[model samples]
Target: MSRIADIAAALAGYDPKALSVDGVQAFLAELVAPAILRERERVPLFEALGRVLAEDVVSPFNVPPHDNSAMDGFAFDGAVLDTPSSGFVSLRVAGTAFAGTARHGALTRGDALKIMTGAVMPAGFDTVVPQEFCTVDGDTVRFPANALRPGDNRRFAGEDLRQGLPALLQGERLTPAGLGLLASLGQAEAPVLRRLRVAYFSTGDEILSLGEPPREGAVYDSNRYTVFGLLTRLGCQVVDLGMVRDDPAALADALTDAAERADAIITSGGVSVGEADHTRAVMKQLGDMAFWRVAMRPGRPMAVGLIPRSSAGDAHEGAAVLFGLPGNPVAVMVTFLAFVRPALLRLMGCNAANAAPPPMLRARSVAPIRKKPGRTEYQRGRVTCLPGALPEVRIAGNQGSGVLSSMVEGNGLVVLHHAQGSVAPGDEVDVMMFDGVV
Candidate 1:
């Protein structure tokens, strides 16, 4: 059987009318595979932000390269203070150790070296008394016997990153800290997978593009822009297909064109049981597709499958995965965040383990929530924290699927689970924040 057939067979038991959120996620995880890039190019460290590492980065040398002082203090032999007779130990300063200077000779007993922070430790000193605890007079320093232990405020060589160790594993995404770490290792360039190319469009006869004159019945297309922003943040090379009318020919042409040029194609609108929608029909002609009624509010109608290349229609020509999102603006964002985002990450060569759903935080509801026990609800909410209290959340005024303003007014989604029913005012709910993607 074909790969599509195998996926279909695996999902044969899924009840389209009442599918669980977990069930949809599990099916997607198994159906999609990482698209690893064979070609890798080096990008400058400054340009490597948000890029995934294509190769393991091994350290060429220890981070510090030498033992050093972690603070501005006096470095001395801890043995001299092991048995101080009067609860204090005094040591004559032999010399000063400054950062960037060469290593100094060993210190004799009852002697110390005035060392600055990050200065290489002298040959025989294993302890440092911070300046705050030391009394310095001319060439001598005094410290309380118990103020410092045998190895206080000293940084050993290779403590952070040892030589020849893997500093970063393959498939790791580079953060600000990661870039700094790479810079410390003297890496000017990073090996990263090429960005994935994603093409997206909106399907609706009543949808209007920007700069077009507004009409009474037509609505401005917002899904395309939202999808664009999301894909751009993920670092994908995005291809905007603009707005396609609800005609079979127009959709088929757009799908074929997008499939030929991009790694994935995303369309918002026309996966539902609407007479004006031709997306479902065109999708079936292009490839094997599954139209699902997921058990989730505002995003029940979804389409997932692969669109074969136009020319050879063979595996070699490659297939572009399709994610047909709901038409409602708020629903578009919710469904994309829940399903399409992770799939796009996997297609970009990110590690499967790192493509899990965004984490949810527990928050107390400030108002009662009316919900059914079957379908999961993603209600837009305003979450706030009080002093010494748990985070409190309340749903934005309108819960309509088409209420885009509600999404704009809220910071997160109150995720009512599939088995959960109505919730009282003080009940706890799981909320997914929009600050960052997992």
Candidate 2:
């Protein structure tokens, strides 16, 4: 074993089955620090959705560029209503103005213009009376006393934005609303962080391809699809390398190809200490591998490494990071969210996207909860919010990572503390909602 490997092994303790999930998460984060982002690119506004921003976006012009009206009414001064029983003064309608028009004319005393909502408020007119409140007869509008305020109906120019302001900071992922903001500022193209090229694969002979006959004790591969969806959601350019058997040579070749073509390589299964697990052996031959047993349940064994491939004939030179998740579906999903997602975001140059939000929701446990001490458990659960009350969460049908139905039926992940052994019915706990489901 290499010196780094030995140190890692000593620091991480033994027994893959005994590694806590928290330990594994911290180890993974430390192992994959400083993942450099790819190159930058200028893409159209339509194509920039979901892409990370390469540079700060500044507004060339202020929003609303000019002062506008907030309501459809007669534009006049509010001080004219200081006297009581003013007895309906009729102001001459000088002209009409609408939104997006330049107001070159100014209002005079006893002269009001019919202004529409969003219309540029003419200089000298500080208030607007809703057209519904006053009757317009020919060129005169009858204004009631105290019908308007000095600034009640005016929307000042640049109130929404200022000229040349830093509207968006660098490392912001473009969302639909973000794109709308860009469009409003007349930005047709955007400078965005280049898409991350991620390579993925699944191991184990028991994992069959879609539409393939399932052999006894074998299950169809779903991790690839799930990871693909998750990566897509994260705006990654995924390259599916398909499934490989538990052969050391085949695994090495796949890793080599992935390192050359992708910035990061993600694989499921085959890193455990079992005899059929050749992923660790292949990684050791290729690069620096660190296997850690975390303190979290559902996910325990995970592998992180910086692959150092030799520049021999047909081999790649630069290092490509590796994340070896567990074969179990739930374990793989949880591990990816807790560990892989942060690294991926850093590699994509998104600063805030990697931050994990707290799952501190109030939930009442409907059934008895059983968990061992010293391991944090993310119990798949279904949560329902009672109107005007806290949400209630119950464990899904089963807690096994291999049970796909459990995740499908779950609305959230009920987080049980590492020291909490078990809880009886009606105990309140914290749950993280999935897809915003309560």
Candidate 3:
């Protein structure tokens, strides 16, 4: 078999989906088990948010070490309670207890203590009376005899958490709210998975760095930034290797540097049999590589492999995994979402067995769409919804992979099936909304 044909067969072992994105996602799950390979590190609570937990976290103690007042009120023994219709009763103010300060005094008959929210209620004081309904002056306070029920205005100890209970499970990503919960439990540090280190860059001389003037036939490099932002959103530490020329020497040097430090290296373009493409040749010299003619549109010639390091000695046995994406801007995007994202996630230790994007939503297309019935297509779209109507999505002006303008202005990708042809107006289509774009 030809080199390209052999590579194609090797990639086919990954089981690309004919038209279903789900099938592609399933294939990725098998290839990238993000939850398996990464190690955990302890981080300050302030820096723990968005980091996945390395293992189940157990609380050192109960959330509330003791029963406390849930509101600003009075703490007294509940034995004084009688009928609901009883009139006001007077009591002597024993002392004041505030949140975060323990109560030093206890309650006795005809005695009440002023308590604030979260204040530890004194022992034998099982109920609280709000100052609103009660009158307080000097050391004396009075409340309606029926103001509170048993255990009113009180938060029982361990109600929020029990001692040694699992506060959080492994593989759960921490959030601001989760951090606060940990704070309430008195945890200052968290055991979290270490950030996954990834190296990626744009390929081809036709791609220019942003802020540089574009010459004829040249476009500013956008995929590197796009993928970089996405990886940051996933909390991965990324090393931007910059743009690589389509020459074997330059490509080999860049790949070598990236393989030395990164868990994986990803590049866009020059993986196909294009005349100027040298990525495949370099991959051959460095490590095993495979090109996949995946049965999908927007991205067809996708490549995956490892770049071997011959000089790293026997310590470096396996090579750094690589992804060579297509040159088209949109194709780079679709292929990355379908393949690379999951693998990166797995490497990050997030239990990211796969990188399946959120489920697609069914929406009505506002205009007609043209396409053949072979490769699946991801068309850029703009979406808007009226208050009482379902969201209506319209295709962007261009479908060409090089048109970065459409991607900049669009909010979602409207997917067309392999068996499905041109879509008429008002036709229902599956649209993947770009939520959480970094």
Candidate 4:
């Protein structure tokens, strides 16, 4: 049996009418396991940003490498401060220690070294008194009694990272901070997973490309550009196939070409129950494809399967995974976020746990929302922080699938889950922000 058929067989118990958002996600996780577990490539540290690590990176040496002073102050033995005869104590300044200079000799009783920040602390010293806290008199420094105890304002060797310990684990996506950590460890290069290539196109006769004049029943294609931006941000190598007309032969050719070249294929439109949908027919003819009526608003019809490469002599060689999204501009964006984004991350070798849905925050509803219980809904909303209460969210005007401007105007999505009824004013709802305030 084909790979797609095997996956479908494994999910034989899945019911589309009663499908939960999580159920679709779980099935996708299993479907793309084979493509995600591939080989790794070694890339330079500077070029490793947004790439997933293929192996654990262990530190070869301590971060600081030596005990040092954390501030510009006097370092003295704390033993002398154990017994205070008065409300103050005085110590003679023996010498000065600057950063990158050789260590001054060990401190003697009643003697202190004037130390600069990051300078190696003299042996037999356990504390530092900030320069401003001590009153300097000629060659001596006086401190208030009980100003500091042992081990204050001192940084020990390996405090940040110890030698022979894992600095970053495999499957970790390298962020800007993560890059700095690797640089601190003197790593010149990192082993990262190979980038996943995705091929995408738009399918419809009514869709017009740029430079085409507006006609009576035609609209410019926006789904391809939106998908391109989303895929590029996720670090995938995107192959733009432009727009394909609703022709059986053209659809078959595009799918075959994409299957041979890309790791996955994403297409918007021509998969729903529409008369002009030649894409669905070509998909079934080329390989094992299943059209699903997902129980979700904005985006309900989705297709998942594998398209095999046909040999010149009519034999099948290999295949690529397929993700067919809805035609509406807003639906395309919503479904891609809810499903395709995480799937692509997994295909790029990210950890499964990290590829799950973005965290949701609770916010009060400023306006009532009309909703039913059977399907999950995502409404574009503007969320604002109240003076002394939780954030309040109100839906952007026009919740229709074709209204793409609402998504652009809103900063977050108000999520209504399955089995949830109509929302009342002042009710707390779940929100997923587009850009989180850190």
Candidate 5:
């Protein structure tokens, strides 16, 4: 097991006192290892939404399985089209082929089969002319000679997916379309990894749970609820530890209990240098902890560590990682999106692409923003896109860290990166959208 000091010492220009946002990310990349996997969980197709596949999903057989008609049309040999001297080519109607039915024998050069969409093509037929394009008589069908080329409107076997090839990869998350693809392959169920178990709670005496009477200098605990929603939306199996007071012993007990049962632990509050903050002390006692003052707005203070599941209370490699977030409403979410989310995805065994942060999009600023160099800032914003114009963005609400309303009205975060100065109205800025994620 690599000690926390060793990991910090390995990074170039490492500074735990004042870490950059990118520096924090790089450290976490080395800190979090993939969770130990158990046997693959076999789940019915209908019930496997957002689950990661335990192994490659291979196709059992070719999709379509055979050549078929792409539409309601007449199937015939395309060779006759070239031999005809007339401007239009005609063929005698032989028989009808409906979907789910098969026909035998070949269609002679001058003969055509009236075939519906998805009907298996009979022997010796390679083209199909849509019914609307052809003029049909009682026993003959006619169409322009150049209406389509040879092999037109005919779907070849294995076109969608071939047999013995991987249709979906391991660690790939299943969405609605993925489930449909499985159904198309005639799979009744899918094999997926077990759900990731995440434990979360809010810490601080000033924080109150729901139904508790409000008192002076105390506020209702909103962080826990927001944390709950975020974890569940990510399809994690969430363990809500509720709100713990400022006492050191209670905090330690809650964290120890959570670590034993969950793959990761998240807590909001008691990470700063406030008098009541004992999270750092307890974390260092139970695990190898690094309390960092990150160079980022709203979420500058955080604690990262690894906690052992055994009763010995000593943290080692490959155990549960802890993320102690700031108490501010907005900070908790910001740190989660910027840091914790990516780490969790990695622990979930997701591939690089899926585990990366949501892409940042370019947007023209609607107004100037005052920002200094040396730290990153995330401002809540609403984007307006007009036809034939680049999308424009403006600040949404109060940018206070403790005020959570800012995150609610906005659809994205206007990312003013480190080393960037004041933004002008027309300057292009980056925005991390919250369309489906928030």
Candidate 6:
């Protein structure tokens, strides 16, 4: 808790009054320390999907283990290709070799062994000419010298992975392909960082829960479901705390309960001004919180801090980080995408390189957009390729904070950065794609 203050004070221009988008990122980067060092668990390959690899997966043996054929062809000494006097290379068809069995005699210099894909290359054979390219007459097979090169269609031992080299590096997020790679290395299980626990809830008396009847001026809570999906997609053990009203004691109790059980807490609503909410006051009493009116549109009202671990004394790992986001649907999403998600990844044991901002796509605006300088704005946009031209983008319906439909309609968010002016029809802009995020 004390270190967080020291960290913020150490920043060159630390200003909670008017923090920039980049400022929020920098603060989080400085504050977050990966939870990977705390502990790791060994999980079977089947259960390791999406888990962060805690250690490098060193290959136990060469991937192929032996030189093998990559195609169904005839394997012969590569030197024979250059030794041919005629324009064609010729060899005696010795014997056939099939996949999964390497039961062929060593081939002589002029002898070619019929081999199937994955068949071990017979001794003295280093090249293969696909059967489709060779003409067989009696026992001899003939092919053009230029038809194949030396070592063609041959998979060398250790070609895919060397025995001593790391097959998968530490901090890698295991995917289906990674699972297959591990299987190739004959690994049955993997060492991975333990899953992160995150608890989230919505705040505001006007926000109604599902199954509740609608009332005038009160909207159903969409932030909980959206946040839940986002957290689940992030591979965290999400603790759904439902929705908390604007009451002070209830908000405090909810935050306290979440902090005790989870690594982080996410709360939407009550961060905005002119609202009779106790979110700020409750945070001040229970945690070391910093409220910020960030220099960003839709999601400008945000808070970040740490809640002390009241349940655990010496056994406690550390304090839980807090993310106080806006109440609006789009704002909550934008803030989460722009800030909370990256911080959570860092906390989830992702290395610095892996936790970097998600890459954005460059696209040309399809129309003029009005904008002012000094603050960043995220606009929902639909991007499409124009065949010959660069990818172009247009606004996606109404860009309202409450408009979740626009987020659905848009494939991405056109990122208008701080200090940037209005955009013209042909202006190029950076867009954060929602392909996997949404």
TM-score of each: 0.94, 0.86, 0.76, 0.91, 0.92, 0.95
Instruction: Kindly list the per-residue Cα lDDT of model 6 for residues 28-86, writing each as its tens digit.
Output: 88766633334689999989988888889899899899999999989999987787778
> Model 6 clash pairs?
none
Cα lDDT for residue 64, candidate 5? 81
In model 5, which regions exceed 4 Å deviation? 34-39, 80-86, 311-318
Q: lDDT, candidate 6, residue 269? A: 88
On residues 1-438, what C-alpha lDDT tens digit does candidate 4 reach at each position? 866556667785577555667777877887777767466788998888888898889999998888899999998887777766987779999999999987745568799889999898888887888898899999999998688887889999999899999998887788888999999988888889888889999999999999999999999999989999888878888999999999999998899888877888999999887788988888888877877888889898888887876532111235678999989999998888888988888888888665766889899999899999978999999999889899999998798999999988888889999889999999999998877210
Residue 44 C-alpha lDDT in model 4: 93
The whole-model C-alpha lDDT of candidate 1 against the native structure comes to: 0.85
lDDT tens per residue, model 5, 5-48: 87798898778777988888888877875353444789999889
Residue-level lDDT of model 1, residues 161-180, one tens digit each, is 99999998888778899999
Winner on TM-score (3 vs 4) = 4
lDDT of 5: 0.87
- The RMSD of every model to the true structure, in order and in angstroms, is 2.2, 4.0, 5.1, 3.2, 2.5, 2.0
Query: Rank order by TM-score, top first?
Result: 6, 1, 5, 4, 2, 3
> What lDDT is obtained when candidate 3 is compared to the true structure?
0.76
Q: How many backbone clashes does candidate 4 have?
A: 0
Ranking 2 against 4 by lDDT, winner: 4
| Angstrom error at residue 352, model 2 | 3.1
Q: Candidate 1 vs candidate 6: which has greater TM-score?
A: 6
In the range 309-386, model 2's lDDT, one tens digit per residue, is 454211123677789999999898877876787777767777654334334678889889987788888888999889
Clashing pairs for predicted structure model 5, backbone only: none
Best by TM-score: 6
Write out the backbone clash pairs for model 3: 34-346
Candidate 4 segments exceeding 4 Å error: 1-13, 78-81, 145-149, 310-317, 386-389, 436-438
